[model samples]
Target: MKKILLTVFAITFFINAKAQSAEVAITKKENDTGKIYTSVEKAPQFPGGIQSFYHYLAATIVYPVDARTKNRQGRVIITMTIEKDGSLTDIKVVRGVSPSIDQEAVRAMSACPKWIPATQNGLPVRVLYTVPIAFTLGK
Candidate 1:
């Protein structure tokens, strides 16, 4: 009967939807490349802790002499790819600024110290994460 078929279809649809929880959906983060995040497994830290990575970078960045933005201020959006073993695999610039400033941003990123590592389900999984750093001259 048409009524019986429609009822069965509706029930099946709901069952399938419930089975596939919304939270379990494979979410492609800003720059997801099918990578996971590393877990905390006790690693060495920079001289003054993980925060030192920023300090070291700020000290190394050299603004371009011809930078149009006299303010010399912009944000560098960095997307980092971490391996399961807690190491940097790839670094990409998502939202980039001027070419000159962008290059400096990449240099600073490459010079960054090891991260504290990220985790998923309490296990070390490679993942891609985006981090933004604002650079202001003489700030």
Candidate 2:
């Protein structure tokens, strides 16, 4: 009974911690030209959809030769602002594995076509978006 209670307490604590962190992130403010939102009524979408966006990434990302040779593999987290006009700006790597790999991920994202801008209260608004690109080596 004690073990079960301990497990339940741990789970509840973890969940509350996670929720708090997410709330903080969603409430973060940006000092850009216009107000940038982290949460929106309708999120921005790729031309076709999420699947098409993945297809675009797969076709555009070129694994850096140096990183591949050095056996560096990990996920790069990128953050960008999707503008009200459906353009992307302020592309940055929030988490990176290596310089070359990170740059490659940025390059691919930079070359992407415009996305459908996010909406809030029935009007288009700029929103902060994050994506993770993974680099892995095949056996």
Candidate 3:
């Protein structure tokens, strides 16, 4: 059928397109740690350290001044994965208040410094961690 053939063609095209980009490969590697290109000798610390990182980041983020980012605009809830290498990646708005606030959440995330990488079974391995940051304006 035409539909099946088109689907296969689309899949193949996407595959080839991904193979052609260095950024795509890097992003994919960042998502998946199974395929080893080089040894990630530097491992991040555990949840305790990540908690500390969050605490510090919370104090450091500059709340956006836009209408939606304001307290009057409601709350911004963001969920993102903190990778094993202590890198913050895949920031997405799980519960969004507004587009402006969503972008602010992402900006706040990017502003954060590197964290202690995560570990698995005593070895440094990439682990998926979830965090929710709520933006609330003052009283």
The 0-to-1 C-alpha lDDT of every candidate, in the order given, reads 0.53, 0.72, 0.48
| Best candidate, lDDT | 2
Q: Candidate 3, residues 79-99: lDDT per residue as tens digits?
A: 445555667766677667667
TM-score of each: 0.59, 0.78, 0.54
Query: Candidate 1 vs candidate 2: which has greater TM-score?
Result: 2
lDDT of 2 by residue, 3-51 (tens): 3323322333210011112233354456756677777767788899765
Give lDDT: candidate 1, residue 60: 66
Q: After superposition, how far is residue 113 of candidate 2 from its true place, in Å?
A: 0.4
Flag regions of model 2 displaced more than 4 Å.
1-32
Model 2 accuracy (lDDT, Cα): 0.72
lDDT of 1 by residue, 1-139 (tens): 3333233223332100111222443444446545442322232233575335445654666667766456556666877665555566578887777777788777776776665554544554555555565555542
Candidate numbers, best TM-score first, in rank order: 2, 1, 3
Q: Pick the candidate with the highest TM-score.
A: 2
lDDT for 22 in candidate 3 is 22
- Relative to the unseen true structure, what is the C-alpha lDDT of residue 132 in candidate 1, on a scale of 0 to 100? 65
How large is the C-alpha RMSD of every model relative to the true structure? 18.8, 11.0, 15.4
